[model samples]
Target chain A: MNYKASQMSQSKKPDADASRSKKIRQKRIGDQLRRLYDDVTNEPVPDEFLSLLEQADKSSKQK
Target chain B: MDDQAFKTELAELIPHLRAFARSLCGNATAADDLAQEAMLKAWKARASYQAGTNLKAWTFTILRNLFYSEKRRSWRRQQLDPEVAEATLVSNDNPSSAIELLSLRNALDELPEDQREALILVGAGGLSYEETAEICGCAIGTIKSRVSRARKAITEILESKMSGLTGNDSLSAADAFEDIMRQADELSRDLPADA
Candidate 1:
């Protein structure tokens, strides 16, 4: 009974460690994605595009 | 169409859409334009978008179609090879630390458009092969093949780049820290430095 308990404890420890490591990796990847988003969004929206979207919105409103 | 509802849905998707576009286009300016064009297309085709379906996948399909259409019609036929450009960028200072990361990005950049799109949809967008196939308007088997090819090509490129670095036995904990710092620096350009 004691041996079984020790064996169970050993398996449990690895699972816990794996979960912790997975969380860390998840957070790191999430942070990288967030950073990529920020970089992409911070750039100036092109003039032709801004004008095009404005025209698009106006056309929709007229309908 | 309910303007408020459309806006809310679009707001939620902008970041993911941008990431997908950027990954496809390999740069910021082109990606923003691609994403904006996609949103416009989505807005115009709002009636076709069935409720409860994948908005991100819909937007991705629009962007991919637009990108290919533009490429086909454009007069500037000679495009700069992204892999070669990436390779050129590798001769920067501190090659010891940043080489692996830069090479990986370069390998990704070097991928064929279809394979890159598949990898981004699966690896980055967290979409399954079925969803990716749907977005790309291809078969599930095709999507799987593209992703497999992309991973293999990228791994090959990265391994070749790292071969020399592996010989240097002095890659210590400090070197690892330097790599993290280098990545953080590159990442800072992509986000608010404070973030």
Candidate 2:
């Protein structure tokens, strides 16, 4: 019984390895996309827009 | 900006920025502020934005700049007190899963800011080493070392935390990390294409 159990566990290792490898690949892809998303939203309004807004605000203040 | 143009950009990037901000700031308040600041900066810099270049990468550069430049980081460091550490995983719904995730987040939070940023950018955020180097304003080797050390520290903490919590030692700690990798993979599959 002990020998059989050991063999069963040994055989299972490959299955586990294959599954884990797949996960690593998926994580890599997911991580890339996540960074892409972060970059996009990180800057909501570019500096140009902010300058324009500042100018408008100043003009209104003068008015 | 025209309604259509603003809508298009918002639709394309808001969710991602939210995720990135959440990871860095740990809660909605700071996350929103970080994202908002990044956006304001991006808008001001719009004229310099090259049309064919990656917009997302440019935006992250802006956000990271703001994060490092602000004096508020000192205050933010205090906010990361051990008292608030317990709250890290309370937001998780499942007890068992929450404990594991909370423990992980707490351990991550405990890391030095540079190490933490390195791990999040590469481990969770998924940037290539080159991209990470660009974002961090460091050499590629530095990025590699930082990420390696960050993972080692996290793994050590996770192993210790799990040891006392669960009586069963059926699988080793290495196995546990593999399991997490698998779950992350599954999450990738389940996530929306845009996500």
Best-performing candidate as measured by lDDT: 1
lDDT of 1 by residue, A1-63 (tens): 699999998888888665554454344433443433444455454565546556776798899
Note the chain A TM-score of all models in turn. Answer: 0.47, 0.52
lDDT of 2 by residue, A4-46 (tens): 9999988988987666655554444344434433533454544
Q: lDDT tens string, model 1, B7-88? A: 5686567767677777766655566667778888987888788878887788788877888788753321123346634553
User: Could you tell me the lDDT of residue A60 within candidate 1?
Assistant: 89
DockQ of each: 0.18, 0.18
Candidate 2, superposed: residue stretches over 4 Å from native: A1-63, B1-7, B73-93, B164-195
CAPRI-style quality class for the chain A–B interface of candidate 1: incorrect
The global Cα lDDT (0 to 1) of model 1 is: 0.65
Angstrom error of the Cα, residue B185, model 1: value is: 17
